[model samples]
Target chain A: MSLLRKGQQWGTFACVWHIFDATWQDPFRSAHLIKKYLMGLYKPIYHPLNQCGDHVIVINSKEIALRGDQWQKRVYFHHTGYHGGATWTLAWELHSKDPTMIMKKAIYSAMDGTLQRRFTMQRLHIFPDDNVPKEILENVSNQIKQLRPVPNRLHEIPQEERDKIPRLIQYPSDYQLK
Target chain B: MAALYRVLNYLGKNVVLTAQNRNISLSAVTRIKEIIQKKEGNTLTFEAVIKPDPYEGRFLKPKNGACAICSSGLDIKHTDVLILSQFVTSEGNILPRRITGLCETQQKRISSLILMAQYAGLMLRRSPKGGLLHPLQKRKWKKFNSYYDEKTIKARYK
Candidate 1:
């Protein structure tokens, strides 16, 4: 095979490392996206029995955003295989106890239940913050686009830009300035 | 009858005397007189001239007298702090409908969006004065990033 064909073959089979930044992203929605990559469904040769899945490195998992009071509303249930061992934890409480747990569980539940599920999960990595190990960081070759644009805080905006934005309302005459 | 007539006459005289006392002021004081006085010398005087707003004509007024927000037809989200901040006072209260010129539905929607933005920490800078901290500096659940769905807003702005 020519050098070009050889390189193409290697690329198709290579377990590429993909990085996803979870800051301001909804974990549940992003789980489906991340699952696609982890399962290597993006590959043309993807098959249920194929060992073609890639590794996904999720960073800033602690900064994940949940929609509309889900932090206090959503509950995670756990059982210890014994009588009266059931426990339920709110989303925010679980996050506080383990920042990466929510993101991990989100992606874990997003995939189908199969014998390969455990092995597939082994390929996924999550970090509470952006402080990934240098060895793992160096292996990452692709960045997964964020599901939504990270909203900017008002205070983070520069004063000049704030002034340049067009005014929508003008105070009427005789209006006292607050 | 004689004593009642005497009491009535005494009350009438006292009322006239009090009215005379109340009228002893040099002149009536008003906001317009105060502003004119400050502009001129120490002597207060009334001026009927219309005061021009510094931001007059800076914004695009709605055609046919429609509300500014209604005419624009912008789907504003909570994260749109720049647009949201325009509807709020410097002290962080929503401007009244009379001044905002927004319709009832739009006013309600904007106020709700402002509240959501404030709670989500998107409008932290515009929050009321009192040692307000950044989102990262806030306590436990609040310190973590959170976002709200505009659909969850109780006020429907259709």
Candidate 2:
């Protein structure tokens, strides 16, 4: 809930939510967290090869916080799969590359390295902002959830192939408004 | 002679609990393992006690989120072996039974876990013998080259 005030800050559209560690019985207050906890519980029993977990949409991606000077030091890696193709982009620079990565990495880390990790991760959706056309929210655990985690256009580019694709094409054309 | 008899009895589907305490406390620790060191009784080797039912055939199929046990559900301490075994193995290849001393059935189950980990990007799909480094990558370089083809390069120079 930090106010937006920056020198060169760009806002993004994401399916954002606050990840609270503790559980809440008030479904309306912390419905998304409750659902994530429940879905995570099912992961031990459910098949990992197939998409079993539900998508968690994060809104207001720009508002997410970092504990310390972590934002300035944190870096994301992408390899072209060639000699000297490894590119290290910072947390802020990646906002231009793909604002959603910050959220995606967060969810991916939580899943750890379970066998169903690949399939269960498919359901995770991270949007930068809420200013999109006809946003779909479904009711699951006593609270409404963003049924679809990803935007209409998903980033299917491989890690090695990301540099080949133009950054402009990464976001939906209408994202300027958000 | 008794050790051979015990092995034969266990493999032949004859439970010999009627004999003296069969739990003979196998020495679980080996020089080869550099993984987590817990109490001696906790760490059992794949060859030492793993008894997978080869006839079952169903254990070959990996369950969702579960690692391969003697072709059965995830066994204790064996979960720790899942990550360590993959790390010790040379690369993308799965470890076979003969060297690991695991029975045929348990070996198959562990192999599937390796495949699943690779698919999840936790492990490599191929070995690093020669393929780890990509070399001789030739891309269309236009540093000082001419017109239309050199447009992007020219703009960068400016």
The most accurate candidate by lDDT is 1
RMSD in Å for all candidates = 7.0, 26.0
Q: For each candidate, what TM-score against the reference?
A: 0.80, 0.30
What lDDT tens digits, residue by residue, belong to model 1 across residues B21-101? 642232323212113223456654433433456566567777678788878878999999999999887666778988787
Q: Candidate 2's residue-wise lDDT over A32-92, tens digit each?
A: 3534642544343344343334545455454343322334466878899999999998765
DockQ comparisons of all candidates to the true complex: 0.35, 0.01
**What tens digits encode model 1's per-residue C-alpha lDDT throughout A48-167?**
999999999999998899987788889999999999999999998999999999999999999999999999999999999899999999999999999999999888899888877777
Cα error, candidate 2, residue A96 (Å): 3.8
- Across B1-158, the per-residue lDDT of candidate 2 in tens digits comes to 99999889786664445343443333343222223224558764332233332224322443453324432443422123233233234434554453444445455545554443343233334535643211112122211111111122211211
Error of 1 at B61 (Å): 2.4
The best candidate by TM-score is 1
Docking class of 2: incorrect
Q: State residue A22's C-alpha deviation in candidate 2, in Å.
A: 16
